[model samples]
Target: MTDNSTTTSSVDLNESRAPLLGAVAGLGAVLGVIAVALRFYTRVVIVGKVFHSDYCILAALVSVVAFTICNGIGIGYGFGRHGAAVTPEEITAQLKTTIGVIFFYHLSHLLIKSSILLQYIRICVLPVEKRICYVVLALVIAEGFTWIVVLFLTCIPFSAMWDPGLPGAKCIDNTAGFYACAATIISADVAILVIPPFLLRHSSIPWYQKLLLGMVLALGGAATIASIFRIRVIYMATKGTDPAWDAAPNGLLALIEVDLGLICSCVATLMPLFRRWHPGIWPRRLRHRGGNRLETVSDLNCVCSESKSTASEDRGGKTDVGDAVGSGTKLGPEQ
Candidate 1:
């Protein structure tokens, strides 16, 4: 009777949480799609010129969608159920799905970071700022590839990751590896978050616009916070015996982090759309009141243009009065 009672309690305690995972994944996928779609629309229609960053973001969105779909498949294979409640076959299937999930998750983040850095490189005029972005971009790319390689190499005879009893199979300490990856990601997130504020400080935009731009970029903090929470969840999941159940939060948080990153990256570019739909909505100071129209230059483009003009003036060159009136000149070749 005691044994039976314990089994009942175990089953009750480990009731499937797949519904929660499904809901979060579904919501994140939908939001990601919408955000990317709006970003493309803004760039292609409103701006009339798509950029390399736009293409990179679109690729990130595709990866995010694939990640969400893989999570859903894993859920169907008892991913959110306690290991004790899941059959061996179900666990194997979920493990197989997990490989894809991890791949797409990392791929999405890599593309997103690259997209943001490319945009920064495109708009930043200062040599120091551009150099910083390039350094960070290199780190992000290196970290992404390193994690991906480590993922595939986690288990020798990689199938042993799921079938741990396979003869002579070996696997690294994946929990420690995950921690290292998370740390790298957090570091990169901090760098991405800090770069914009530093650049903005040196920009020639009005103080109010700087504040607004800072606030928009500040949304990246949401993804950073999500990464921190994900690390916490990883630690918690490692402590639990029922990895299939405990790890659900890790997947959910991963989706949230990727989706948040993609959304935040796209929001600043959507400014042109907002202005087009509601021109008078901007503050009088932000909008052109006299012959000095702000035009429809993107926030980053405006900063780039003004920075170049400032640099030109600082060099004691004759500055065109029209340049200050939002001429919307292309800074250089699109990076």
Candidate 2:
């Protein structure tokens, strides 16, 4: 007989899905759709018919959709229910769904990191910034492929991961391995985020504008935080036996993390669209304010030149404001 704890944790397969499982899965789908829509609008309408980053975002959207589909299927198979309540078939399906989820998780983030890096490379004019982006891109590509390979190879003969009763089937420590992958993914996330901020630091843009950009770029870190939560859930679920019941949160967190990454990837590129839509928004305001600062400097220079010119004319028409007296010289940024 199953223990009381098993009964308490497991859900009935015939019943509605667990709230956490359903809510997260549904929210992920909704957010992923919105993200992709915004991405399409930005790339098509504002960005002039797509770019490399747009392709990456589209690929990430596809992966997140696949991830969401897996979550939905798992939900029907007692994903959030207690292990004691799930049939053998339901649990098996859940395990299979798990393989798909892990694969898509790696795939989605791979696309996201690619999108972010591509966007950076497109805009970064400095050689140092381009070099930093290249290094980060290499890191992202290496880590993403590593995790993808690990997820697929974590089980030998593969089918053995979900079914321990198969002949000659063997599986590695899934929870620990996944945690390692998640941690490394988060590390990669930190690296990607750090690259942009460091590049922004060297930019001539105002410090406040850089700060805003940093915050926008850091949105990808939300995925990292979600991965942290997933790691904790994985650690706890590994110590337990309720696969159907315990794996729900892990599944939900996986969808959430991936979808959030996709959404944030689009968000980082949508500032132009946002500025066109909402002129008073922070991005536009930042640009406007920066322009005003430049205008102020130009005005001051003009005033200084006029004062010197008036004084020069007073002193026998001797002028020091060469080519800067009446012409409004737009000052170039200080190197």
Candidate 3:
């Protein structure tokens, strides 16, 4: 017979990743809130107006905050300990929180991608550019809806997801579903990243300004990288028997991916604030009329409108490759 003392000692020695998960989740939440707040200040107070994309991002921030809270709740229920070390009640509680995490995680990504695509539609000048954004936006929405349905229907009677001991409990192949979701999300990320360069190439802005904009837009790549790592962790977790212990890394990565997306999206819109504080940071030629006006990629609608008007006048109502775009208007000047 196994010694009771030895068994108790072994259980006590089991590794727990709760602290690490808690720290990462807490830090990510703090940074995400700050980023979104700054973005709103720049758009509403500094720019004097807000757009649909801004509201979408605000919703995304709410979803991410919810996602973070679910993670925190899970941690309190012994989410980061080995399955064998945790009581069955703790496991049930964590599993219930897992459903919440999945819901908020998907919601966060849907809103974030929608925000980016809406921003693209506002900025793009060409018919083809707007069409592409619409197509991508539709795809994101459809995928999000389909997955949400799958999430709820994965178990014949949803409660079976958390309490597998239910009478005749059943669940779909979770591993397959997760893999498919990850693949589609990563694909959408790559598509979003590619659209900016295409829009910039056709813009009338100077090459230096294009380069500056490219750097800011490239921040989205970091979120894609996080997605990649998160998927790898998911793969490993699927192959492991200790789901609770394995879940720590997967949850940490998921939080990072959503938070990174929020932070990066908000940072792109903060150019006006940056320019107000540091006029000299922009190229000399870009400073219009003694820096009273300055155009930025973030002001997509204004820029595209200005481009169309300039093109009409320059080409005498005729369009050409060289006259496709024109200099855009100032985003806004600091008072």
Candidate 4:
């Protein structure tokens, strides 16, 4: 009876958790789609198709699509698990797919950061400022790539990571891997968030424009918050050495955070164009007065005033001439 009760409780717990994870991942996927659509609309319509080396908005779009697919898969797997028991092989496949999804999740951020850095380069007119920005971009790219390498290859001999089902494979310290991932991700998120605001503040654009850009750029910080949330969830979820308990959620959350961040980064890149070109076809107010009529009326008034002034002066009275120059003065300068 005791064993049966324990089995029932375990099944119930898994059943409950699966749907919740599915819902979260599903909502993220939907939001990703909307963000991507907004990005493309801004790029093609507002910003124009002209390729500016500095403004590569397409990176964001690609990121959003990648995220959507990843989250969609998660949602499917999560809900599937809730509905029925999946084999260890199925679960392992799911875990491996998740790992791949998250790998691209971080990769997408690189594209976005590059797009934003390029935008900064686009509006920067000064040689010194441009050179400094380029240098900073180079450093950021190097760091991001380094971080990616560390993230993927941290355990060394990649087979060990997902080879738990295979008794023959040896893996590294799980705790060390977890902490390393958490630390590097947090550091990278902070680094990416830091560079943009500094770059934007000193950028050559007008102060108001820069402020607008800064607000848009701050969207990337939202991903940082997501990263922090994922870290917290992972810390809470994966306590035992079993590894699978913590690894699955951690991978999923990482995907969610980075995917959202990339989408936001792309959206921020398109913000300048959106500001310039409003999405709606807002109707302009029609004035009763035409441009030519306004000019014609002014011309007629000038001619009439000239004739009146000449006749008043011809009367040859100094008082009449003074009165004409004062109250009924000509609309235009005297010839």
Candidate 5:
């Protein structure tokens, strides 16, 4: 019986450590890749051109910084820098890093998404429903900010948030802090996905086109899911000996939530540009490459075409029989 108990304890210990290590390593790799991508995008895609007012470059910079800091927190925790043997200062620093990175990363994401959605609206026709949708989107962004405020205030009794060698440090009230965050993120994500379908439903565009738009915009939903997943990891991270294991999954989800949200929001914002491009690529038959030739032969092919009746009616109403007959004869010869 004692042997079984010891084995169970051993298993629990390993389980607790695994997540922290995974989070540390995983976040490091994710941040490194993102940094490289940022460099490439700035160098190759923009080519030193600040010609457009997209502000995408600024968003990219914010994301890079947020992710880098988050990875640092993960690595610190993974290495047991804040373990039981560590000093109060180290524990405090780790918690501060974790909170700072998560907060800034999410805030930057909200700002960028709002900017993108506004840009999207500026180009679109903006019917009454769409305007309402924009208002709702604004509210969602506002709610996220509110949550950030609450999180800060909750931690504001900051000295109480973390302290090594204190037994009651285990009892600090974080329930409100984390739950508020979870609610805000989940609600915003759902709102982003829901608004697209409702706004696009009444558009003059075809149903399939609206569906395509909804699907593209729905990518924000993934970020919401990531937040939920991160919350679970966070619970595991904070409850146990090594919180760093939670950092990898938490950082990964954070990066995903911000990055995917930006991409989805940007795509939605550029919908008008896409709409304009699509019509040029797939114009009506009369507006196709052979459009001029078709018009030229239209009169000659009148019997097989619908323009004949309209043309005859116009000629008859003009009260110029001689010109009408001359034109008709010429049209007949061409046919």
Candidate 6:
């Protein structure tokens, strides 16, 4: 708990926090909105239909709204600022802000991970990969639910979390919770990021389009990197010294990680707009790398999660689908 008596150092910390927290969180929210907007347009307008993954994205977007609102409140309450600057009466308010941030942080990750899982359902084709994906999804759900429960119940009598001296109050070490959640996020993100590259390995699509899909899928890794940084900040925050100051970075990183996850997931589904912008955007030499080549490129709307064919059927149509990949682009595969 922070001392009631404040120091000049506390004021300095408090002054720096507001702008830094707002700027980082605002940037994340903006980037997330832009990416998700593109994804929605790509699905509803360009593809003319939505899939399971789109629904997931929608749900994640709702949580993002909640997360952003909580972020504003938290920062307003001196969340990332020094706790000593908070008056005794304001302590409860600051603590409530912390609760809001934690609650929404968990929700954002849960929804974003679910979105990625649903995206995997639409795009992953192999039986082995499908099995792996299913297991990962189950774990993600379990982990997310666990964290939700843990965060909500972390301090008994709930208010004890903020008012540390409350009688009969007990709180769990938050570092454990942070570690568990970070592990879940990193593993799931890595799996989703690696999946597309693995799926296209033997794809009948030309190497040019194959490379493009690979690049798109790789975008999910940005979230994974953000998660790592969030974990580092979490470790520091859980150290129990000047927590309010520490929490600034912790909360900021959480917002960025979840927002980045949402953004990356949405971007992975925006191939339609990319292909639409340039109908003839295929590269040559890379097209020669894949030994066997197809006459048609699959501008698969499913790349945007807009396909009628199951991922399995597309296995046979790999060549045609690859050819159809762009709105109106065709590159001759080297003979």
lDDT, candidate 3, 1-335, per-residue tens: 22112233455545788999899899998999999898888777776677888899899999999999999999999988877777999999999999999999999999998987887676565777789989999999888878888889989788999987899888988778888989999998998888878777755555666666766765654589888987867755555566787667778888889889989877677766776676554432333445543443333333334444333333342112111111112221111
- Among residues 3 or more apart in sequence or in different chains, the pairs in candidate 2 whose N, CA or C atoms overlap within 3 Å are 9-82, 10-81, 10-82, 11-81, 11-82
Q: State the lDDT of candidate 4 residue by residue for 177-207, as single tens digits.
A: 5566666656655655665456444322234
- Candidate 4: how large is its RMSD? 15.8
Quick one: best TM-score, which candidate? 1
**lDDT of the candidates, in the order given:** 0.73, 0.65, 0.73, 0.49, 0.47, 0.66
Off by over 4 Å in 4: 1-14, 50-60, 67-86, 147-157, 165-168, 200-212, 236-238, 241-252, 269-335
Weakest ten-residue segment in model 3 by summed lDDT: 319-328
Least lDDT summed over 10 consecutive residues: which range in candidate 1?
318-327
Candidate 2's C-alpha runs over 4 A off are 1-17, 283-292, 295-335
Count clashing residue pairs in model 5: 4
Clash pairs (backbone) in predicted model 1: none
Q: Give the TM-score of candidate 1.
A: 0.83
The candidate with the higher TM-score, 1 or 5, is: 1
Q: Residues 22-75, candidate 2, lDDT per residue (tens digit)?
A: 787788778878877886776676545567777787888888888878777877
- TM-score for all models, in order of appearance: 0.83, 0.80, 0.82, 0.62, 0.59, 0.81
* Candidate 4 Cα deviation (angstroms), residue 303: 43
Pairs in steric clash, model 5: 19-245, 20-244, 20-245, 23-248
Task: Give the per-residue lDDT of model 6 (tens digit) for 183-233.
Answer: 887887787677666656645545567777677666756778878887766
Candidate 1 global CA lDDT score: 0.73
Query: Candidate 3 — what's its lDDT?
Result: 0.73
- Please tell me which model should have the higher TM-score, number 2 or number 3: 3
* Ranked by TM-score, top first: 1, 3, 6, 2, 4, 5
